[model samples]
Target chain A: MLQEHAKLITFFSECKELVGRKRLQKMIYILKKCQFPFSERYQFHFYGPYSEELTLRVQELINLGFLQEEKEKKSGYYQYRYTLTGEGEKFLDHYNLDMPNMDEHIEKMSETSSRFLELVSTMLFFEGMPKEEVEEKVLTVKKKQNYTSEELQQAWNFIGDMGIQH
Target chain B: MSYQSEQLREEKVFKDPVHRYVHVRDRVIWDLIGTPEFQRLRRIKQLGTSFYTFHGAEHSRFNHSLGVYEIVRRILENFKEHPDWNEDERLLCLTAGLLHDLGHGPYSHSFEKVFNLDHEDYTREIILGDTSVNRILKRVDPKFPQNVADVIGKTYSNKLVVSIISSQIDADRMDYLQRDAYFTGVSYGHFDMERILRVMRPMDEQVVIKATGMHAVEDYIMSRYQMYWQVYFHPVTRSSEVILTKILHRAKHLYEQNYKFKLAPLHFESFFKEAPTLEDYLKLDESIVMYYFQIWKDEDDEILSDLCNRFVNRHLFKYIEFNPNHQFEQWMELHKLFTEAGINPDYYLEVDSSSDLPYDFYRPGEDEERLPIHLVMKNDELRELSRESDIVEAISGKKRTDHKLYFPSDFIEALSDDSHIKKRILEILEG
Candidate 1:
C-alpha cells in the first residue's frame, strides 16, 4: 500500500468507526493542524477545510475493499459512516506503521458534533491570525451559521484543551 | 480616496471573440490590466499543446483571463439585487477573476510536473510580493491583496464570494469551457451559460442554481464532460504533452550532468535549480520556452537535441492503448527490447493516464469530489443536483480513466525489418 493511504488506514484502525462527511474532513484537518505526518493538502470550502486528495484516497481504499462506507439519510440530507473493513485490519496487521498515540484525540473528536468541528477547523485554518481577527473572520464568513460569542469562546477553549494552540 | 471605488471616465472594452466584449468600468481593473505582469499572460498559451491538435487553439491566458473577468462581471450584475449578496466584494471578485491565471508558466501543467512548481503558489507570491500588481491592489486597501489572494486560493472567509469565482459552475469554468471550445472549434463546450448565470443565487454559504435552471446546469456539466474527453484530454494533445514533458526532463537531466549547451538555458536556469524567483518565473513564457526548444535542437546531448527537435517540429510521439497492470510482462519485455534496440525507454517511452469524474454528488470519501452543485428547489428547499436530474444521476460518481503507452513509432519504424530485435518489439507493440 502507498504510504499516504496507509497513514489514513492506520487512522481508521485507531478510530474504529467515524461518521459524517463533514466531520471526517474537519477531523483530518484539525489533526493535520495539530502536526501529524498526514500529508493531504486542504483548501477551505464552505464546510471549513476539505481535502480532495483525502477524499480520493478513501475512495481508493473503499474500491479495494479495505474500507467500508455506509450512507445514512438524515433530515433530507445524506450522512456517511466509515470503518476499516476486515481486509483493512488484515492489511494493517502486516505493516508496522510508526504512528503517534492519537486514539484519545481521535475518539474525542469523533464524539463532537460536525457543526462544532467545522467551527474548530475553520478557526484552525485562520490559526496564524490574531484571536480577534480570526473571530471577526469567522463571524463574517459564517454569518449563516450564526455562531455566537459564547460558541467562539468555547472553540478557543477547546483548541487550548486539545493543545492545538497554546 | 480608496482606489477600490475609483470609476473610469468611460467603460473600456476589449473585443473578445468568446465573451463578445470584455467591459471594464473600474479604473483599478483597467490599470491592473496594463501592468507588465498581467501583460505577460499574452505570451503564455491557454491550451498549451492543444493548438497542435486544434489549429485555432492559439489563444493566450490573456484571452481567457478577460473572458473570466467578463463572466464574473455579468454574474455580479445579476447578483446585485440579491439580499445575500454583499456589494463590497465586487472589486475583489473582478480582481480575483482577472488575476486568477496570472501565475501560469509556459505549458503550465507539463512544466509544473517537471519542475514540481505550482502556478497557484506563484499567483499568491505575485499578488503578495513586491510587484506592480501588488502595489496596485494595495492602493485599494492594505488588506485588499491578501483578500484577493485568499479568494483565489479558496480560503477567503466569505464562501459566497469564493463560490462565485471557483464553485463547480463558477465563472472560471464557464469562461474556460466556452473560450477553449470557441478557440478549439469544438462543439462540446457549448451550454446555456446565460441561463446558468441568471439562475445563480448567492446563498448564505455558496451559490445555488434555481431548480428551473437544472437543464442548463445539466448542459454545463455535460459540456465539461465532453470538453475534458474531446478537447482537454485529447490523445494527440497528450502525445504532444508527453514529448514536451520528456524534453523538459531530458534537458533538466542533462543540466544536472553539467552537459554544456550551445545556447545557455538562461530562462530555465531558476526552474532547473527548482528555486525560481518571481522575476525568474515571469521571464519565462511559451515564447521563451519555444525559443529554447528551437535552439536546443542542436545541443551536444543526444537525448536533449532529439527531444527538443521533436517538440519544436511537432514530431510528437504516437501512442497505443496500454494497461500496465494487465500487460506488465509484455511491458517489461518491450522495455528490454527497446534498450537492446538502442532506444532509451526512459526518454523514448511513457505511459500517460487521464481520468475524470464527469459529475459526482457530495459522496464522502469519493474520487474528485467537488462540492456538488446544489439546486434551489421549489418551497425553499436545497437539493443536490444528481438527486434532481436523471442525466446527472446516470453519470454521477463514475470515474473514467484512459491509459496509453506513448512512444516514437518513427524510431521503431526506422529499424531494419530483418533485425530480430525490431521484429519482436514490433510484435509486442502491435499486440
Candidate 2:
C-alpha cells in the first residue's frame, strides 16, 4: 500500500469523524505547517489552502471501502461527513504510524469551526512572515471575510495552542 | 489617475490567429505589451517540445498571453452589470491575465524540474520586483501590483476575481486549450466558449454555469480530457522531454564536476548552482537553450554530446509500455546489462509517468482544491457538474497515468547480432 494512503487512513483514525471539505483541507494544511509528514502540495485557492492530492486520496479510500462519506443537505448547500470504515481500521492496524500528539491535535482542530480554520490556515501559509505582516496580508487578501482583529488574535492563539510557534 | 485609466485614441488590436483580434483600449495594457519583460515571451515557446512532435506548434507564450487577456476581456464584458460581480477589478483581472505566463523560462518544464524553479513564483516576482511590468503596474496604484499578483497567484481575497483567472474553467486554460490546438492543428480543444461565457453567473465566491450551459461545460471538460491525452501528453513529446531532462542533468553534473566546456555555460551558471536569481531566470529563453544545444553537440563528453545530438537533430528515443512496479527485477537486470554493454543506463534508460484527473466534483467525504464546476439550476439552486452530466461523471476523479520505459532503440539495434548482452536486453525488454 502507498504510504500516502496509510498516512491519510491513520489521520481518519485519529479524528474518527471529520466534516466539511473546506475544514478537512484546512486541518491537514495546518498540520503540515506544524511539521506533520503530510506530503500533499497545497496551493492558495479561494478557500485558503487546498490540496488536490488529499482529495484524490480520500476518494480512493472511499472507493476501496476504507472510508465512508455521508452527505447531508444543510440549508442552501451540501455538507459532507467522513469516518473511517471497518476496513479502514483494519488496514490502519497493519501499519505502525508513529504520529505523536495527532489525536489530541486533530480533536482540537475538529472542534473549531471551518470559517476560523480558514483564517488560521491562511496565516500559517505565510508562516515565515512577521505576525503583523501575516495579519495585514490576511486582512488585505481576505477582505471579503471581514475578519475582525479579535478573530485574528484568536486564530493566532489557536495556532499557538497547537504547539506551532508561528 | 488619468494615466491609470488612460485609453488610446484608437483601440489597438493585434491581429491574432487564435482570438481573431486581441483588443487593447486601455493605455496600460498597450504599454504593458511593449514592456521588455512582456516582449521576452516571444522567445519562449508555448508548448515547449510539443513543436517537435507537431511541426506547427511553434507558438510563443506572448501569443497565448494575449489570447488569455482577450478571453478575460470578453468574460468581463459579459459580467459588467451582474450584481455579484465587482466592476472595480476589471483592469486588475486583465493585467493578471496578460502577465500570468511572464515567468515561464525557455523549455520551462524541463528547466523547472532540473533547477527546482516555479514560473508562478517568478510571475509574482516579476510583477512585484524591479522591472518594467512592476513600474507599469505601480502607475495604477502602489497596491495595484500586489492585487494583480495575488489574483495570478490565486491568493487574492476577491474569490470571484481569482476564480476568473485560476479556476477549473478559466481564461488561462480556455485560451491554452484552443490556442495550443490551433497551433498544433488539432481539433480536440474546440468547445462552445461563447455559450459557457454567456451562462457564467458570478456568485459570492465563484462563477457558476447555468443549467442550460451544462452541455457546453461538459464539452469543455471532455475537450480538456482529450487534449491532455492527445497533444499535451503525446509519447513522442514525452520522449523528447526525457532526452531534454537528461541533457540538463548531465550538463549540470559535468559543470559541478568541473568538466571544462569549449564554450563556458554562462547562461546556465546560476541554474547549475541551483540559485538562479530572477534576472538570471528571465535571461534564459528557448533560443538561448537551443543555441547551447547546437554548440554542445560537438563537446568532449560523449554522453552530453550524444543527448544534445539526439535532441537537436530529432533523433529521439523510442519507448515501450513499462510497469515499474511489476518489472523492478527485470529493470534492474536491464540496467546492469546496459552498463555491461557499455551504455550508461542513467541517461540511456528511464521510466517516465504522466497522470491527470480529467475532472472532479465534490464526492461526499472527499476533499478537492479545484472549485468543481457548479450548474445553477432553473430554480436558483446549485448542482455539481459531474452530478449533472453523465460524460463528466464517468471520467471525474479518474486519474489516468501512463508509464513508459524509454531507451535508444537505434543503440540496441546497432549491437552485434550475437552480442549476448544485446540479446539479453532485447529478451528482457520484449519478454
Identify the leading candidate in terms of DockQ: 2
Give the per-residue lDDT of model 2 (tens digit) for B52-78: 999999999999999999999999999
Instruction: Report how far off residue B309 is in candidate 1 (Å).
Output: 1.3
Cα deviation of A53, candidate 1, in Å: 5.9
Supply DockQ values for each candidate.
0.17, 0.22
Model 1 misplaced regions, further than 4 Å: A1-42, A48-166, B355-370
Candidate of highest TM-score: 2
**Every candidate's lDDT:** 0.83, 0.85
Question: Which digits, one per residue and each the tens of the lDDT, describe model 1 over residues A51-118?
Answer: 76676667666765788998787775667789999887776665567888788788778767878988
Judge the docking of candidate 2 as incorrect, acceptable, medium or high. incorrect
Q: What fnat does each of the candidate structures reach?
A: 0.10, 0.22
Please give, for residues B1-431, the per-residue lDDT of candidate 1 as tens digits. 55788898888999988777999999999999999999999999999899989999999999999999999999999989889999999999999999999999999878887897878889999999999999999999999999999999887877888888887778888998999999999888999888888899988778999999999988988888788889888999998898888899988988899888888888888889999999999999888888889888888788888998888788889889885435656776888999998999999988775521112223322222346688898888988888888888776663455668888999999999999999998888898
